[model samples]
Target chain A: MKKLINLQPSKPVRVLLGLLPFIILLLLYIGASDARLADNPNDKLLPSLNSFVEAIDRMAFTADKRSGGYLFWQDSYSSLKRLFTGVGISAALALSLGVLMGAIPFFRAKLSPLVTAISLIPPMAILPILFIIFGLGEFSKVVLIVIGIAPFITRDVLQRVQEIPSEQIIKAQTLGANTWQIILRVILPQIMPRLLAAVRLSLGAAWLFLIAAEAIAATDGLGYRIFLVRRYLSMDVILPYVAWITLLAFIIDYLIRLASAKLYPWFHSQEN
Target chain B: MSYLNIQNLWKEYGDQIVLEQINNKVEKGDFVTIVGASGCGKTTFLKMLLGTETPSRGQILLDGQPIASEPNEERGIVFQRYSVFPHMTVLENVMLSRELESSPILGRLFGKQKKQAAEDAKQMIELVGLSHALNKYPHELSGGMQQRLALAQSLIKKPRILLLDEPFGALDPGIRTDMHQLVLKLWKEHQLTIFMITHDIKEGFFLGTRLWVFDKDRFDPQAPNAYGAKITYDLPVGDIDKETYQQIDQSLTPSEPEIAEAS
Candidate 1:
C-alpha cells in the first residue's frame, strides 16, 4: 500500500473530493436551520431552505408593488450596467496609458510616477469625495468603481507591456515600422490578451466598489436591496441576494477565463 | 565605395567603453561572422550595425552615406529569443513585415494588397521550410522551427543586410546543422550581406565568408573599463587552417583571468 503523501487520487475521486465540502456545508446549514425553526418557529438568523426558496420567488417572480418591473432583475440589470461601464472605461484608459508609458520613454518619464502615485492612494477613501462632486447618482457609483480598479489595471498593463522583450520591438523597427506602426501592429496585439487578464483579476475589486457605492446611495441595486431589508432582520432576502451576487461574480469570472482561452490561445500556451 | 563602412567606430555607456577604434569595410555579399568571449561587446557591435544602438563617437557609413541612427527596413535582425512576435501565427508573423511597409498608418493591408502580401509571405515561409506550420503560433514551434519562422519573418522584408546574434545557440546539435544549411541557402539565394555573432568558433568558421575576433588589445586590471574590445583579427574563413582555429578557440574559451578582467 502507498503512503498517504505519495498517494494520488484518480479523476472520479478528485471530483468527489472537490464536492465533499459543499455537500457537508449544505447538510450542516439544513440541520441548523431545522433546529432553530423547531425551537421558536420565527428564526431570522438561519431561515429554513423553504423560506429561502419563497423569498427568492417573491423577489424574482413577483412584480414589485411600487415599481412596475420585477425587483430582482431590475436591480441586477442596473448593477451589471454600472459594473460593465466602469470596467470597460477603466480597461480602455489603462490600455492606452499603459502602452504609451511602456513603449515610449517620454510618456514613461512624465506619467509613470503620476500613475504610481494614483495607484498608491486608497480608492475607497475618495468615495465620499466622488459622491460629493459627482453627486449621489449613477455617475458617482460608476466613477467609484473606475477609481477603484483602473490604476491597478493600468499598472498591470504597463508592467506587461514593459515585459515585452526589447528584441521584438527592434525587429519591428527593422521591418520599416515607425513609432505608431510599431505600437499598433507589434505592441497593441500582444498587450490585448494581457489587458483581458488584468480586467479579470480586477473584477472582484470592481464589484466591491460598485456594491459599496450602491449600498450608500442607489435607489435600486442588488446592494441597495440587501441593505434595505437588513432593517427588519430579513436574513431570508439578504441570504438569497448574497448567493445571487456570488453566482453572478463566479459566472462572469468563468466567462472571461473561457473567452481568454479561446481568443488568445498563444498567450495561455506561453503561460504554460 | 564599399557597401558598408565603419570608420573608427566607438561605443560607450557613461565612462565605461564597450567598443573602441573599430573599423571595417564590407562588400554587398560578404557574410561576416563575429566570435568573442562574453562581455566583449560583440552584441553591441551587431546592434550598432542594426542601427538600434548609436556609436558614441565616429560613424557607420552605408553606400558612402551615414547610416540612419534608427533601425530601418534595409537591415533585419534575428536574436536567439524573442525574434518572432508571439501573438501572431507563423503566417501572420511573416505577413506583418510587408503589411507594416505597405500601410504605414493602420499597419494593415486590405483586399488585393492583403492577398498579395499573404502570397509573398507564403512563398517566404516555404523558403524557410515552414509551409505546414503556417497557422501555428511561436509557442507551438520547436526552437529550430521558431528560428525558421524568425528567418521567414525577417526575409520577407527583403533586407539588404541580415544581422543574426547567436541564432542557433539554444538549439540541439542536429537542429543546428539543419538551420545552418537553411541559412546558407537563404544567404546565397537572396545575395544578402550578413553579420552574425556567435560564441561557437567552429560555427563562425563554418558559416561566414570572413571571421572576426573581437578582443581588447589593452586591459586595465584596476579600472577594468579603461580599454574596450577591438577587431583583433579579421580572417577570410576558407584560408584559415586547423591550427589557427584551435588557437582562436582556446583564446575565447573563458580563462579565469581573462573573463574576470573583461567583465
Candidate 2:
C-alpha cells in the first residue's frame, strides 16, 4: 500500500498517463486500417481513414437522396431523446421508491424482495414481451430501457438511502415532519446527487437496453441504422456510428458528473 | 402536576425491565442532567421524554395531557453524532423546519415570511456562535462547531423540550466547557426544559439545575430483570446545604433523598 501511494505522480502527468491507452488504441487501429487498405482497397472489414471520413461527410453533411433528411442528426436526436426519457423515468421511480423502501418499514418489506426478484430476471428475456405488449414502436423501446435499468437504479438508490443515518430522519421528525415531510424535506435533497450517480451507473445498462430495443425494432435511430446496413456489411457506417455513440455517451456522462459535483459537492466528496 | 410528568413509568423488553417504578417531574426552564452507569437506560429515559419510545406501563404527561405517540416539534433531540444534516449549510439546517413547516410544494414562504424565517434562522445561528459558519457544511466544521450548529437547528424550532444524548462527549475539554456555558445561556434565554444524558458525573452535576443518579435498586444474581433502575438520587444542585450533605453521607447511600424540590 505504501509503495502504491509513493508511486503516485503529480496530477497533470497522471492525467497524461491515463490518456496513453486511448492513444495506443488509436495508433494501432490506424496501422491496421493502413495495412488492410494496402492489401485491398475495397476491404469492408478494416476500411481506410478516407472511407470513414467520406462516410461521416455523407451521413452528416449530405442529405439522404431518398429520405432528404440528415440521417446522422436525426438519429442522434431520436436516440438522445429516448435515452434521457428512459433514464429520467427510471431516476424518478427509483428515487421515490428507493426512499420509501429505505426510510419506511412497510415499503421496505413490501418492495425489497419484489425489486430484487425483478432485477435478477434478465432484461433481454423480457424484451419480446415488451414489444408484444407495447408494440414494435418507440414506446416499447423506452419501456425496455426502463425495465432493463430502473430496477438496478432503484436497488442502488435504496442501498444509498439505507446508508443515511437514522438520526437525520429522526431529527426531521422532531422538526414537525410527518412521513411525507420526512420524505420530501429530509430524504429527497440528501439523495438527489446520489440518484444522479445511480443513474450514471445504470447508464451502461440503459444504453444496452436502448440499442437492443432499437436494433430489433425501430423506424429511425442510431442502433436501427447500424443494424439496417449490416446486410451489406457496411463496416464504414457501423464503425463511425459506434464511435458517434461512444462520443455522445461520454459527453452525457461527463455533463452529469460535472452537474453533480457543482450542485451537490457534499455528495461528491461523500463518494470518496 | 408539573409542566412535564413521568408517572410510574416502567419500560421493559419481553423479560428484562430497564426502568421500573420511575416517577419524576420536570418544571419549565429546568436544566436536568442525568448520570448513570452504562446499560442503566439513561438514554432510554430521555427518548421517552421525546416520545420516540413509550413505556410499557404508565404515561408521560405534558401540561396535564398525555404526550403524543410520535415525535413532533414540541420536542427536539441532539445526538453526539449525526445531529446536523450533512447536506445543508448551518443556516439552512437551522431554517429547514421553518421552510418545511411552511409550505409543502415549494417549501417557500411568500416575500415577507421568507425574509422573516431567514432572519430568525440567522439570529439563532448567531446565538449558537456560528455566525462565521452559516454557509459551511457540517463536515467542514469542527466537532464543536457541528454541535453548535445542531444546537442552533433545534433551538430554531423553539421546542418545548430539548433532549440531548452525550452532546458534548465528543468535543475537546475546552470546547466542552464552552458548550456547557452556551447550554446554560440557551436554557435561560429560551426557557427550555432540557433533559440531558451524560456518562460523565462531573458534567452531569456542573451543568444541571437538577442532577439524577440512575442505577438499579436490587441486583439479583439469577434474576436481574426482576428489578430495574429507579432514580436513586435526585438532587437539586445549588440548593442543598451542609446539613443535607451530612444527612446524605449518614444514609447508606445518596439514593435516599432527604429532600427533593417539587417540580
Candidate 3:
C-alpha cells in the first residue's frame, strides 16, 4: 500500500504547515466580520475586511495635514526608537554588571540580593514613580522599558555567567588571564549568546511597557493611536494597530533568533 | 630547592580532612601519575598544586618560589571533561592566551601580533593533529579531538607544569592508547612536567615515570578527620612494560606499603 503522507514533510510542505494556522485564523476572522456587517451596516465590533483595508490605506498612504507625515510610519518610528533604545541600554548594562556579579565573589555577594529583589518587583508598579521622577516624556517611557526589562536581563546574564564551567575560568587563568581578563575574554564570550536570548525574552515586556507609557501620555505612537480611537469605538483603527504591533514584534523576534544562530552556531550544537 | 617541592601539605574543610601530611618532590620533566580508589583526594591534591586551593599547613614551591594562591600561567590542566572552551574555534582556543595578553581591552589582538598568534596557534594545532579542524568549535569535534584541543590550548601558554585529571577516562581503549603515546611524545618534546591522576591502575602504571598511591593509612569513623588520605606508596617506575607492572602488582599487599621512599 502506498502511504498517503511521508513521515516527515519536505521543505515546502513544512512551510505550509507553519502558515496554515495563520491562514485559518484570517479566514475565521473574516467570516465573523462578514456575518456581523451583514447584520448591521454600521457595525464596528468586528469590522468588515474592507474597513480594515481602507483604514490601513489611509494611515499608511495618506499624509497628515498638520505634520505632513504618514501617521503609521511616524508611530512605527517613535515606537521602535524607544523600544530599541531601552532594550539596547538594558542589554549593555546587563552584560557589564552581570559579568562582574557572576565572576567576582565580592560583587556577587553584594549585588545578587538586589538583583533578585528588583526582578521580583512588578515593573508596572513603578510606572507612577518613574513618571514622577523622570517626567511624562520620552525619558519616562524609555526608562519604563529599561526598568521593566533590565533587571530580568541582568539576572539572566548573571545566571548564564555563573553556569559557565569553573574549569574554563581556571583554564583561562592558567593561560595568563587576570581577573578582568577572565571576565572579559573567557566568561563574556560564553555568556554573549545567552545575553541575546535574554534580550529576546525581554522584548515582549519592553513592548508592553512602551505601549503602557505611550497610552497614558503621548501625542503620537501606535499605542496612543489605539487608545485614541477606542473612545469612538473605532475597532477598524484599533485592530489594525494591534495587528501592526504584533507583526513588528514577530519580525524583531525572528530577526534576533536568526542573528543569534549566525553569531553563535556553537551555542545551539552544545545544547545537544 | 627541588624543581617542585611540597612540604607538610594538608587540606581541611570544616574539620573534614581531605589530604593530610602529603609530602612529595617532583623534578623537572617528571611524568608522575597518582592512582587511588574513588574519594581518595587525588583530584583535590591536583587542585592544590594548580593553586585553586590554599594548603592549610604547608607550601608548594616551584623553582624555589611559592605557587600562587590562584591559578596562574605557570600551571596548565586538562580535566576528565569540560576542559575545552566550547565557545571558541580550535584556532581561537589555542590563541586565547596571546590574544588576551596583547589586547586586554578588545579580547582580540590585531595586525602583526594577530598574525603571530595565528601562526603559533596553527603550529600547536598541527602538533596536536587538529590542523584540519582549525575552524571547528569544540562540540563539533570528537572526544579525542576535544581533548587534543584542550592540550593544544594549554601547551600554547608554555606553562611550567601540566596537570591531567583522568583526561583519557572518557575515551575508548584504542583512543586512550593513542592519547597515552601522544602525551608521552609531548612530554619528551616539550620537556614538560606532567602530573596525571587516573582510576585505571594499568594506565597509571603504564604512563608514569613515577607513581604515587593515595589512601588513608588509618580509618576511624568516630574521629574522621584525625587521619585522612596520604601518599601511601611512591614508586619509581623505571620501565612500564607488562612484566614490570605485573611484578609490582604481585608484590603489593594490604598491610605493607610498596616502595614508600621512592621520592
Candidate No. with top TM-score = 1
For B212-257, candidate 3 gives per-residue lDDT tens digits of: 8887878665575677799887888764467756654543333233
Instruction: Give stretches of model 2 more than 4 Å off.
Output: A1-5, A270-272, B239-263
Ranking by lDDT, best first?
Answer: 1, 3, 2
TM-score of chain B of each: 0.95, 0.89, 0.90
Residue pairs clashing, model 2? none
Clashing pairs in 3: none
Interface RMSD (Å), every candidate? 0.8, 1.4, 1.1
lDDT by residue (B149-211, candidate 1, tens digit) is 999999888898899999999999999999999999999999989999997887998997999
The CAPRI category of model 1 is high
Model 3 spans > 4 angstroms off: A1-14, B239-263
For candidate 1, lDDT tens digit of each residue in A1-272? 98999999999999999999999999999999999899989889999989888988999999888876899999999999999999999999999999999999999999999999998889889999998999998999998888889999999999998999999999998888899998998899888888998999999999999889988999999999999999989999998899999999999989988998999889898898
Q: Give, for candidate 1 chain B, the lowest lDDT window spanning 10 residues.
A: B253-262
Top-lDDT structure, candidate number: 1
Fnat values, candidates in order = 0.93, 0.73, 0.80
lDDT for B250 in candidate 3 is: 47
TM-score of 3: 0.93
**Where is the poorest 10-residue window by lDDT in model 3 chain A?**
A1-10
